[model samples]
Target: MQVKRFFAADMRQAMKLVRDELGADAAIIGNRRVAGGIELTAALDYPLQPAEPVKPNAALEAELRKTQAIIATAQARLSLPEGLTAKKDCQLFGERLDDFKNDFTGADHVANRVAEPAPEVVGPAPVAPHAYESASQDARGLDIVRSELHGLRELLETQLGSMAWSNMQQRQPNQAFLWRRLQRMGLPATVAHDLLAKVAGIAESQQAWRMLLAHFAQAVDVVRDDPMDEGGVIALVGPAGVGKTTTLSKLAARHVLQHGSQSIAIVSMDSFRIGAQEQLKTLGRILNVPIIPVGADQSLTQALAPLAQKKVVLIDTAGLPAADPAFRLQLEALASRGLRSKNYLALAATSQAQVLKAAWHSYKQCRLAGCVITKADEASTLGEVLGLAIGQRLPIAYFTDGPRIPDDLHRLRAHQLVSRAVSLQLAEEPSEDTMAAMFASFYNDLSRKVG
Candidate 1:
């Protein structure tokens, strides 16, 4: 087999060049549009035995027919006149053709010499998929070869990624470790780098950790204390299955426990779910507080009229996808109706960092007052929630770690939340090898500073 490439101002000129040089025996393997014109890849094949009879297998006969028909159609479509003149600006094309011919014909390798094109022993033009598919043994062998090549490509890519990571680890051990730790917590690269850049000269590992924590603590916006104490209308909003209803119930329960059941009223705007209103009602019954259901057409202002005397009205909104048209429209409807509400995005701690960020971004149209982090007990790492809290500058209003109504809900504390993040790091990681030693050293440095 021999491979060659040709470039021409147009397909007609390229076909003319191919016909004059390689003749009709050359097959156009591939074509692509170039800057000035088009580029074509052509190949020729020479078989050993010329007098051998062609035996077509039953299975491959259909495929070969299809392939031959397509090739024939393409050839007919690109048919050129025999009297066509070659372009005088063929200097560039001639140079490339000569270079490819020299590279193929002048090769010193034994295999290359064997596969060299011969003038008299012209076989079928090189097909995109060779005769391997037509022969059972060759087909099976090529399948194994293709699989091995795929595995080799994956292995190479993995090796390259590892090499790049290794280089970073070697050059900036401290920074790399810190970055990886934050990333493990589900922080985006952009957020992680921004946090790292804020850290100034740190003589000790403890200081570095503390500085980062302090930065994280300061970076997070917190409502501090119970939001219900200062709340009027607080709504829990987020995507589906994020525990919005559960978090809203938890908040309502907490408000009732602190300020009594009479002053608190829980409302469900999630009429989409079959038993969503009932779920909130069940919780409302448990707390002996009024539970109201608001429909899409019903005026929220009118619904809250009876609860006007209540100190806190917690709204439970329908959980929706970020891209859902109803998601933005619901918020707009409330705003247009002059229904004032403080939206607290109920985010699950077990969610990926990007997912949590997306929730925050999507619900920002509602002008989120703060966030309620849920499913804390289910999460192995609080990094995602913590990263989200700090990165979005949205204060952590409440946390619901368990299914317990008021028992699981607690107001977020900056120092305590930061402490939990560090504790999660210690508990989740094994205290073995260099990584464990690094962690131990980090804490020991902090202990010394504390002393």
Candidate 2:
């Protein structure tokens, strides 16, 4: 019999080499893990030696028969199932052989089992490319199903909302009219719904409308006394380019005209801007008040120490992005208990509702005393800022309509703000689809609470 040895990185590779070099009929006798791979000893034509007959002793014969029976039982238990592929069958056979050797060879052999080939050396069967493609397709199909379900949910909501709105118009026409009127004024559905709830049982449309306007005006909280009149250390805080410096100048000019510039001073923490300090200096020159330019290295407490005698010290903070470390530090300084400074958020009326809201959240860390609505003359509608102030319950201290310094800054008047919002109301009614989409979630929330 011609015998040869084959070496390969894995069992499958070794088996392939054996078949290619020694042909399909070659019989594998011994296999072992070698330096970098496995070694298989295969023979083309293996010789089987016949056993000679022996004279039997009864006791010895009984012991030999019992051992043969145990060997047969173990082989039967380790046999591979017919359903498994040839590759899997080969792997299972090798594992079962190792297990059998470990069990019968005693603890010494089992302890040295680490010398045997690791299971990972054989590796798992390679998954076909089609299997991965199938899985990817399934994931894509699931995403499509989710998207369709979301669209279906929105459609159902819109239809249900249309039906509910129709019912409201038919049952309570007066309330429906007032709700539509509020919507025309550009009020969010949530705020309009809340205001509508206040005049629930009023049957007359005109009276209900009048009462709604009154309630709307009352909802906007304002400072009883103007900041210029009250005169304290006030810091104007907001995002960059919302007119902090301009608003500060306006406040200083107003205070200078009314209370004299001697009692007031301006502290600029806006050193980061290119011409910020210069602008404040120019304003200081015009108003005859001292403009204290606070550098990044200067402590706000140290800067304000000498100005303790001043009645109104307006701080014009740098309009830095909320993410900046300096922005947070400035807010922390203003919020410090010892400073006792009233921080007022400066919001631009021309900004979108979301921008206005974000500005409020960013500056609110300073314990905002109130807000100053800037750029009112440029804004097409006042509803956005009005809604923000009313929703956040932030008192409006002043409103600046123009760049005319003291001429533009006016004390907050609730009725005038409400009337301005009304005058800017949209002339055309909202489309049916628009109204349905807007009120769908609102009506659904109300139904859930009522039910």
Candidate 1: regions farther than 4 A off? 1-164, 322-325, 426-451
- Alpha carbon lDDT of each predicted model: 0.64, 0.74
Writing each residue's lDDT as its tens digit, candidate 1 over 375-446 gives 988887887787777767888888778998769887767877877776666334321223322222332333
Q: Give the worst 10-residue stretch by lDDT in candidate 1.
A: 84-93
Q: Counting only residues 3 or more apart in sequence or on different chains, how many pairs clash (N, Cα, C under 3 Å) in candidate 2? A: 0
lDDT per residue for candidate 2 within 176-226, as digits (tens), equals 788778878877666787788788768888998999999999999988887
In candidate 2, stretches whose alpha carbon ends up further than 4 angstroms from where it belongs are 1-123, 441-451
Question: Best lDDT goes to which candidate?
Answer: 2
